[model samples]
Target chain A: MKHFAAALAVSAALAVPAFAQDGETKVIGVSIPAATHGWAGGMNYFAQATVERLEKVYPNLDFVLTTASDPAKQVNDIEDMVAARHVNALVVLPFESEPLTGPVQNAKASGAWITVVDRGLSVEGIEDLYVAGDNPGFGRESGEYVASALPEGGKIVVLRGIPTTIDNERVEGFQKAIEGKNIEILGMEHGNWNRDDSFAVMQDFLSKYPQIDAVWASDDDMAVGVLAAIEAAGRKDIRFVLGGAGMKEMVKRVMDKDTMIPADVTYPPAMIATAIELTAVGLVSSAPVSGKFIIGSVLITPENAEGYYFPDSPF
Target chain B: MKSPKIQMSVVGPVLALVVLLVLGASLNPSFLAWDNVTNVLARSAFIGIIAVGMTFVITAGGLDLSVGSMAAFIAGLMILVMNSALPSLGVGIPIVLLGMAVALAAGLVAGCLNGILISRLGIEAFIVTLGSMGIYRSLVTWLADGGTLSLDFGLRTFYQPVYYGGLFGVSWPIIVFALVVIVGEIAMRSTAFGRHCAAIGSNDQVAKYSSVKVARVRLTTYVVLGLLVGVATILYVPRLGSASPATGLLWELEAIAAVIIGGTMLRGGFGRVWGTVIGVLILSLIGNILNLTDLVSPYLNGAIQGAIIVLAVILQRDTRQGQ
Candidate 1:
């Protein structure tokens, strides 16, 4: 049934070009990472929804959406879009920066407007637009929340994400935010932004530190694991855990005023929607959408948690 | 000298484990604490349980790359089953039992499918499992709708004890892992099935001429491994009460590495259930110790783990050379 509707939509899109003789149908290709994790899954959901919605709103614009599991596959996807589809614009969330730079540049060389999302290309100026979530703001928002929550400046442990530039930037921003505060970091370890890894790491941290006042899980998935470990340990020293990425369940916990999960920070996966929409506007309209669009991360407290709650979103 | 060398090779994994334990204890005062000890052991349970079954499969000259992905798929299926059944069964033991049954059944079917494809169709074990690996991973991802499949909150709370609670001081996973190891060791050493596995792995044509049912034994090995993966998933689901695309990632490599580290040959023929247990413990301890201490940079954790795995295998290899 769903595929039938999709086929119908494709047919309708094809018919639009025949009637509207004023403008030739423009093709916009969107390339993103496959939904391998919660955030990417949410990103995939939003990207697909945006493409479907935009295809209806703009009759003369057609979209080619491709998801790749790796950098090589992503590069191939872009090359195929440029060569086969003859896309007028390319919206890509690179799986990695270094490998995607050359391919995206090649797309630009083909006279396609290139919009890079999240991770930037290694060499700048190739992309007409850059859309990203504020990594530093993500960490700072989380840190600022922790500071305000524990005004006395207590000791906390941090569970970091995978070792990457994004992880590094977030951690640096968090450290800078909490630098003047009296928060003593008991320990820091990479949970690799995974639940199982964080669970094990948090368990070990529980064994190592007897009086951890709080935890900075840094990601919602890791927070789930950290919370489970702390619950199993039955430790009373930890007051609350601040998780970022605004996953639905965590936001729900904040909404209910759960003490363990007092707050969350937003690094929304829906930023992909923003990127795709801007690129669509550039292709169909005369709007100048050729600048960096960084979505600032916001702290989601209980009062504002309801607003950030995306119950329908998979994340 | 030959006798001593043989003894050393036999005890290589044991020696490596002892060294890690001592190093861990010396580095941190709480490393040997009861809680920390249980934490490490329980954490090792999933891979430990899976590696025991891997021992049988390897003994029978088969390899399974699908166990990890199979576990993920089964967990997803179990969660879906249990969640849907919650309306009728409520949030009690019956619902949990139903979930476990679903897991075991799914595992049985998945394993049987792999067994049939490889044993009946004459496909290579590596190729068959490699194909199933991609298939199972994609299935789980599709089942999850590219997100996570989480068990209902009420059910998760009620079922949490399976993972966190245990008789006496040991967690359930550790208890289950210990039981699996004990049975596995006995099977590998005492049973006719065990001898047949060794025979088949060492030389299948010779074993066939010896009147052993080579195909059945090979199929049974896969079936056992699949069932064990289901058991592992039962414990895993309750821990997080969720399954995602990342669930059980790289677990096959870890299980295979443990099997090899414990003195099981990758090329098949010889196997040891007890050694695989030790291998599981060794891998768990490396991660635990790295997390417990800031001795080296966190970035080098993978490098350090690789070095230790190589060192442990080399220790056994040198002793085998003397034979």
Candidate 2:
């Protein structure tokens, strides 16, 4: 029974590629981290919307999108895409750089075009197209905004995301941008980019510090927590809060010119859409879509908040 | 000398908690202030309440890894139900009560499902709960469409008092947490149900021969735990007024850690409610102290917490060996 099952599985695996050769259709497998938080949720939304939109535009393109909850699962997902789907192009927003490197390289070895999104693989020159939101620019844009917002130089606390190379890059960019600007950083702690953790951390920050001029929450989700903590404490000293990653609710507050949330920085989750669209374009058309496409992180204030607001996006 | 040593066994967790308090207060002046103390206690309330239920579960040789995801899933359902009913129920106490009912009902059903699967189907508690954990987490993520399910603004504001407000100087979460602990202590100490759980956990064949109805007792423990998780969610939803996939992440681990640190045996047959409260406080205080001062790198926060939890268990172990 076991031998028969193995033979049946082998034959089924062989049957998939044979079936794919019947048409001029190109298959693009898009792998991403699961929607465990706000930003990833938005990424999932945009990826699905883009996939649906592209399917209508290009009749000969097939798409397989898989969301993994962890790095090992993501690696398996990439492997399955290569083994089962026989994808012409593989678009992946890797969960982590190191573990996913070999799996992505294997996909590349299978003669499939690789579009690495957001997180880059450890090995260089593996991905044919790389699209990512600028982490350094995300931090620099936020730092520049802070420096401009507090021209007179005031003390601020920072709520960082989970510890990672990405977080370190953003913090380094922020510190570099704020150098010589006379802005004093009171403290920095990881909020893990979640609301509850930030809420508790912000409350402790409030208790520890008698007076804080402003807060750089670094992400909109953290900003929401920070703002709530301030409201609960009824602290009037905080002039404004600067949160990045333009969440729809935060962008809406900025659009309305809320005093507490004066402005936001953009680390749009829609970058997933860009990678999927470009991969689709490269598969179907003659457009050269191989190279790094870095989406600049822009500041959203009352003036430009309207353009960044996406009521439909979950984030 | 033996009596004193036996007393010291019970004092291990309390002594550790006291040390954390002193360390926190010494590091920051405001650490012992009423506001800061309340914040820490209120934050611990969610885990503290769940840990109380967890004490019973662990005492009965059962574990529910699904509590965290179960809380998240219940919160999501509560928000969805309230939002959809807002047109008819309106933004008032009726809507808030309705949301609470939904939370309790969902938690009860979820808990019952796990209990039946484990007790009736004769499945291992760990495997059953592990499966339910993934199921609940994924269900919430799917229900929210991979986003956050936020209660309507007006309704959220109206429902805020359940978490933020109190009768005099205490917050609702803290009050609810204290009540649950008191009731849990009584149930675990005086009730026949409690002895049945311990007996079953110690040896199920022996318990059955002793006519304890081991399966019924096991089922009740899970049902009770589910109800308390529901209670915790009632206060939790009002605080954030939203539920996402990130809500209550790793909470089961925290609750389990607190239970084990409080001297409840992971292998079962022993439990403590007040000690679990002390354990919960110790865990929260570690995070609070790490945030209140810059004594160590923020990256070392988890390492510090890990060290303390192990040290706490070791302290209890030494006292047990003395016995």
Candidate 3:
């Protein structure tokens, strides 16, 4: 099975050139957030890596990648790409939802194929394709793991990410998954998806409560902070830390099956790579990629950890 | 007259802290716990230490938007240097000491660079530091490849003590923060250089006429700011055992906020070291209070924090005017 998977990846990588014969070179514009924080950094990494791979596979395809620190700049960037770059297809992960909607709508109006990654624009149906990781599933998967791990129903706490619609959905799904179970949630607080903030919040959790069976740090960066806090406090009661987003370091721990971090959930920053690849394929071929591509959150355990691990990838 | 300025500088924040403490304790009894209080203080050390340097800069009529990125860059460099040293040096006392030295030196250099650009070259401090912020942030990102620069596992356990260790009952960070505050207070309040800084900040032409060597005084303050940032980074790196380019994000603003909240003027000519310490405590306590009470939705956390800062500044203004 492992060999089959490797073979599949190799063939899929090689298949892009063979699949694209659109007669002329097509320019693809990719816009994503600059490397301001960990996840975006990873997104930027994967976006560049995927572009490199695709460019080699399909020499006739040209790519223009633009990273913006803010929404207004991103709008200006997208406008420039559409007007001057003469982009045949546009792939964007918006800095924010609402502000980018009208700009994206204008980009769409220019007749370029639109593929939006990660964040969805406020106005729906603006893009020809939408690609995102399952945030609610990410929360639910984490909750379900804890539920089964502690079948006797023990007390647990949660450290949420920044309060966004995504954060709300993740928390809602988490609460929904753990409802009526033997688990008692001791407390929940926002870590703002930051390592330092998570460390502080975890410290408070440890001090406030005497015993906590487990902790769900919704993002891996926060989980790193949570683990540090637990170690510093010298508390052995926390059975495992469940952190999502498949950061390389955390996933490596899961691969090694570190008792402190036994598992992780996937909300990959590389989904941008996936969106770009699919968009490129669509632009080259008659592939029907107009629908939403919702990437499922997979529970990364010790058994299948190597497949998810990317030692070279930044995230 | 002395008492009035003290009232303007220190009393308001002290009172604010006392009222906040009472409110926090009433809202949640755990907010006043000894362990939690130390935790908040230890965590605040990063901002508190950097704000000390910022006090000098602001008091010298300068601002550094690059301190946050500078801290991140320094920490990242320290970790990389330490990690590279581990293979040959081993994770012993020497390696740890070497890492600390590298951190301080990096901080000094980064600070000097900022100082020279702003003071000697006559560039606006704001623009220079702003450009340096991008440079430092990007340099770290390039070094980490947009991921994390983690220390060697062998060194992690040995060096964790710097942050978690204590002298007596106080956490190491709290002790360090106190020492920084004490030394900073003396340097800013009782020394000739302190007066020169105030003089330069008050009026450069007047200071020049008074033989203050305005540029030299300004340059030294930036160096002080950078050195303090280095000190903060040394404490910060151990807590997480790694440094990301994202480390110290927006810390410059936080440090400045603490300085202003502590009653330092934005336009310069005043240095309030102890007041800045109080400002750090107030902000730290507010975060603690927020964490303890979960009733405030996390979505409103930023809004609530902003409101409190505005309220504290308003109260300070009213007190200063009355004084």
Candidate 4:
């Protein structure tokens, strides 16, 4: 155990000198939530791809990637990686906003430039760069797209994500966009952003409502299950189904002209990769990068689904 | 024949199902529709199978927390396997059968490990499977590199038919679930091993003296449970065309709930295969009925599920201890 720690320390030390001289070998620390579901899983994928591409393009650079299932663990992980990997700069897609703020602040305090992705802290301005997909847009776009298609005001069921500010923001935005629209929401329930859970929730919704015009499954994983349950019941009244997070399967559905999946809402996982790239560039290139990088969530209609489709991406 | 406890055991769950149906229909007239009723049964298949295996585990006085994650892991691995084979094999029926066989073997091994650790090594079943649960979940996540294990379109139709098809008027999942119930019932009744399982669960010391192979039975139950989880995976993965760690999150609790609510003792002695089947159906039915209704809030759906499960269980507990 002692030898393992020492080896990590030595390698970290060896890599630091190389990084300091050129600023080219700047260490990129990629912290993402563990793969409990599809979205985070895809984020990890892009994080990895970004690391390899940056390393090959910039020979002096190195990448250190880690994951945590929750905010508390992520804080501890940051301390561990900074010590063992000699991360010169940090890129974090936190598990939660508030619990992670202190740890991120500490990393920033120690001279590492910070790039925060997705979730934002309740306390602001600690991060040197902030990158996120607009959550409100996720809700509003999905609500607008689906509601527009059902102009006659059809009944719809909604499966929500976990109770977080992001979840709430999306819900609020969606509800607002569809406000005064003909859509009567049959019910809204938390599927906790999962396929099987959504399947259960959708099954319940199907039994509860005699007639439903559509479904807005807030997230892709839930969208997968809701569509499955709907198909099993052979319900045609569910004119279209839409979900946020450009999961490859959902994107593919739109691309293939599947009538039920007329469109999708984009909450791309690649934003983390984008964050890491910006942080890496900030260290070496002397580029003027000060503003918050808010990636727009575009509605993926059939005409635009090909642009969002990633045949190679596991998500 | 033997004072009819067995027949009553079977009848209890059926009676509960009828009550649920009546209550559901009374709450909303649409619940009785053939489409809604059939949909609830079809959606219940995953838990039905897991609960069946859990019926054996709990009745044998053991627990397996890894069942859900094990199901997800096997599903992910099977999809990965199928995806790899599709390019080479050109998306045929034979490849799917081969994939199923491999996934079943992996699940059986996982179960056997849980069994041997608990029964032979004398480890607590809870702790053993709890530890195995983390390991299995981590393995699947690592294997997929934290991404979805989607079946590409080339072979989707070839394999999709299993979850999508119906036998007579029933869904394929329901058909598979009924087959599991039948096999489980026969195993519990006619097999020497089945009698020994009951004897051991009732009293291991007494069972040992009575020439029951206590260790063998306990060890094998895990494998049986594992195989059932594998079967559940075969039906499950195609539903979404992918598997993640959340695939079977907290499912063991559901399966244990089904077994206990079905009136099986948590200790090692009793089995209620048919009761467990209905128990699973009731769980799905509660969720379905709640969603279909114009409930004040969807959050109530969980509270309702929890309430019904607790009520069913308390009712079973009171009745069992009555005589």
Candidate 5:
């Protein structure tokens, strides 16, 4: 009698309606950083917005957005999202490189096409398509801009972001560019990508160094903190305070040609959008779309600041 | 009551600060600049403000994890209110006062939620605020649509004067932080609530039997904490054009660090507002010096922060044992 009842229940479960998209559901999974910071918040916004738009455009494609605030949660999320059998393709912006390798590999092994954005994975042959902004380029361009403007190479104090791979890459790239030049990096400290932390860091930079020709505030958010501290100090020695990452306010400063902010580095948040588009085109079109994808990092100065400016969209 | 204990508390942190300076200057002479000293005090204001509150909660036998997210939520709300009213009210004194009032009220509500849930509901303050931390953070993310809501361009200059403008050659945030310390000191010293607070921390059941309204004390303390956070946000918002989800990330940790390092007992028995001020300053100074000198790699900065926090706690332990 129990066996008979179990059989009946299995039949009933099979009869339930499918949750997948109607025409021919091709599951697409999205993994992004949890909406912890403003940038990640915008990243989540773009991911969700694009998923909605894509579902409307393609009847067969169903998208699932998963957000994790930290590295471990992201790894677990990838595992859970993959195990649900809800995806034919996966797009991930990893929280950290080391911990996410196995999960991305597992999802790829399960026959899902893969794309990794922003932070890269440690596992090779995992990401079928990769989309990313150039950190080295971010550092090089900002460094080059500094070199050109300060021909004689003034004393520069650098305020770094949190100690991550991205931070290391940016600093390495920057140092490489300024090598053998007159430019001296007076000091460097990690502001941990926090505004108040950066403010304190910049303040110490000012005090520890009697004369500073300029400042490189690696990220725009940190730049805000650095600028506040500098302004509070009321020092005139800083001819320029450089910031990167194409934040809206930083872009605005570039447009206004604020004496302190003459240029910026672009690390567009729309890379997720780019990854989605490429993945969709691969599924929909006859063209070969499976390959490594690289997006150019353009330097934004007074001339091109307006083009990169998005007054409505939050960065 | 004023004895060798008070003087001992004063001597240790001062020695630590002086030693840190000596070490910093020896490593890099540029560390003694006027600008840097000013910078450390200025940036330490935020952590200092929150730590002052944590000093109360911890001494009172409670902890608050909601501060980081609560501060961000209040900042976002303050900005939204300020921007909405900018057009209706002129850029005169009234709008500024009104904006500050709204910010403070928002903080009180947030704090009240914390106080009510823990004190009244009999829930652990840590777990209660931790849940609220997620809730408040998510709410702001939803409100912002995961982006930033900056001040409208027209009102940027009008609003900026609050942060940029100074009285007596001191930044507004610094001045506000100072007043918070003074008020916190007075409240914890002169008020009836103050005496009761100590008795409660020392022995909750005993204090309860002594006719101290235990629940009311705990609840009101949170509200006061909320008010201070709100005030900090008010002074802080003008410096930044927008409020995003990252507004107060890890501030709870920093504030806790300041409290722990400031000689406040984490297990709940004592809170020292002035010790917290010095603690915040010392913590802030480390970050400043690190930025000024390339003595250590940037990656090791966290190690430095962790080490300093441990050192402060150890010194406190030593002092306690000696007493």
Candidate 6:
């Protein structure tokens, strides 16, 4: 169960500035998942920071932000916003795709501009704009890095995230990119995007295979687990571990040029801010910001790690 | 007939574990490798250690849904204490020792809170722990700001050996688990306290009539469980070098599941410490074997795990009936 208190804590931070829509002031309701995990925590931080920054810049724009732990709570949150808050526009990062569709569609019927972020809804035409991080690109860039780093070919293992369409897309992109390469994937297993689970999976991988040249831990959290297991095993053969989703700690490692953590890939949670900004622009300006906007996954190398590192970010 | 319940508790889980190991070995020869065996056993340390305490809690007719969250909360506090003290303590043995002391103390306090509320205040264990579960999880989330808390890098290398290090050729976590299980089994079998727990769980009214000090025994069980969780955190943080707010998510369920699968009566009275250890191994082995194979889909793994748990429970039920 999601913490109702945390949801309240997130919304309470941004609920003070109650502004009514008059000449150009538009109320934008921001609904996103609560900080249940590291990624979601980072998303919430960015969402709050962006709202705080934008409210000052656009004096006529007001944001009503609410965080929900589950789909049902999120649905209730949206319905409440549409009914009572009288939101002119809604920017939502759904807790899950299917559950939020009907509620969002209902909001849309009430004339709210729907800006969906990250996970897409089952029904396509309901949203006016879509902003999402590139899942395939995240894997493809990670694959491209692996291919280039081990040009001589090596034995690698994969620690996959949760079994979802996103995971499949990342794996597909990775496989497609490394199709003809000599980098043989000895094994692949799900880490469930959890640190402890990943640690256990990596330990088994280390024991099962005598020689593992490198690792592709798709998510940063799992990458942390993989690194810990490798260290605990005191294995010396591993050249480096590539983890995606530029978590600050991982990025810091890259910046420090740590041997085990050579680089990283970006699957930023700040894409919510992008959605918020676009929706705000659409409401205030004459700009037509409709259609899918996929953020490219950028590879974080030693030289560029500092640019991606956000020390203040919760993640 | 008197030994039948005992046989069901000991023999059943052992059989299930053996069958699983044999099946895994047949599926993949590498699953039987010495290193794989050690790795799987060592990885079970977290759940194994916690399940020891769960044995007491469940035997005393109590439930603790807060163990997982308490682990995370306590782990977070330990990391914070260690990091802040690292500079003054100079990355020495003293800091590590101090961290352990703090961890144990924090666990005892947290456990006592749950125990006192349930035992003294007359609240149901389930309701008390479920409330504390939310409280503990939220506290950790707040502590980490919903992120991660890593120990000082200077000490990370030294602390790594606590988990990764071993005596002679054996891994440390495995050794630790063995020690804990031995101690736990001894306490639950050889002591009057152990008998009191069984008496309390079997029937609180009967235990009270016998002048067993039911509240005191029940409260002590929770405290012991918390201490065990503390020990788990010590091993866990050293391995990961960080504690995320998500560190112990849903671990309480796994611990509870291990306890039940080990033939511990959920309604109270029966507990098998060794069986609990086997139960934990069974759970870890399931994940390990699944990971080793290419046939099982990742999504299907959860369903498979659920099926095994149900099968184990059913097997235990049948064996109990034979008595």
Q: Report i-RMS for every model.
A: 0.5, 0.6, 1.5, 2.0, 2.4, 1.4
Q: Give the CA lDDT, 0 to 100, for residue B101 in model 5.
A: 95
Candidate 6 lDDT at A296 equals 95
lDDT of 3 by residue, B1-323 (tens): 45455454456777787888898889887777877888889999999999999999999999999999999999899999999988899989999889889988988899999999998999999999999999999888878877888888769888888999988778888898899999989998899998998888888899999998898889899888888888898898888888887789999999999999888888898889988888888888877777777768766777877877777777678545643
Residue pairs that clash (backbone atoms under 3 angstroms), model 5: A34-A68, A208-B30
Q: Whose TM-score is greatest here?
A: 1
lDDT by residue (A64-147, candidate 1, tens digit) is 888898999999999999999999999999999999999999999999999999999999899999999999989888888888
List the candidates' TM-scores in order: 0.98, 0.96, 0.93, 0.88, 0.90, 0.94
CAPRI level of candidate 2: medium
In candidate 6, the residue pairs with backbone N, CA or C atoms under 3 Å apart (3 or more residues apart, or in different chains) clash, namely: none
* TM-score of candidate 3 versus the correct structure, residues matched by position: 0.93
lDDT of 3 by residue, A1-315 (tens): 232244335545554664575446678999988877788888888887787778767767777788887899999999999999888999999989999999889988989999998889999899999999898898899889989888999999899877789998998989899999979998888898889889988998888788999999988999999999998888989998889899999999999879888989999898999999999999878878889999999999999999999888878
Give the residue spans of candidate 6 off by over 4 A: A1-24, B1-9
Q: Of the candidates shown, which would achieve the greatest DockQ relative to the real structure?
A: 1
Question: Which parts of model 2 are misplaced by more than 4 Å?
Answer: A1-23, B1-3
Residue A109 local lDDT, model 6: 99
**Chain A TM-score, cand. 1:** 0.96
Rank all candidate structures by their lDDT, best first, as comma-separated numbers.
Answer: 1, 2, 6, 3, 4, 5
Model 6 earns a TM-score of 0.94
Writing each residue's lDDT as its tens digit, candidate 6 over A102-163 gives 99999999999999999999998999999999988888899989999999999999999878
What is the per-residue lDDT of model 5 for residues A1-315, given as tens digits with 9 covering 90 to 100?
A: 232244334433332333332335566788888766656655665676676666556655656677887889888888888888557889999888889998899898888889999888887778889899898888888888888889987899888877778888888989998887899987777777767668767767666666999998978888888887778667899998888778887899999989888888887887888898788777766777777877767889999999888765667
DockQ of each: 0.89, 0.77, 0.58, 0.60, 0.52, 0.68
Off by over 4 Å in 4: A1-26, A57-61, A82-88, A151-153, A203-211, B1-19, B87-92, B189-191, B319-323
Deviation in Å, model 3, residue A295 alpha carbon: 0.8
State the TM-score of the second chain for every model. Answer: 0.98, 0.98, 0.96, 0.93, 0.93, 0.96
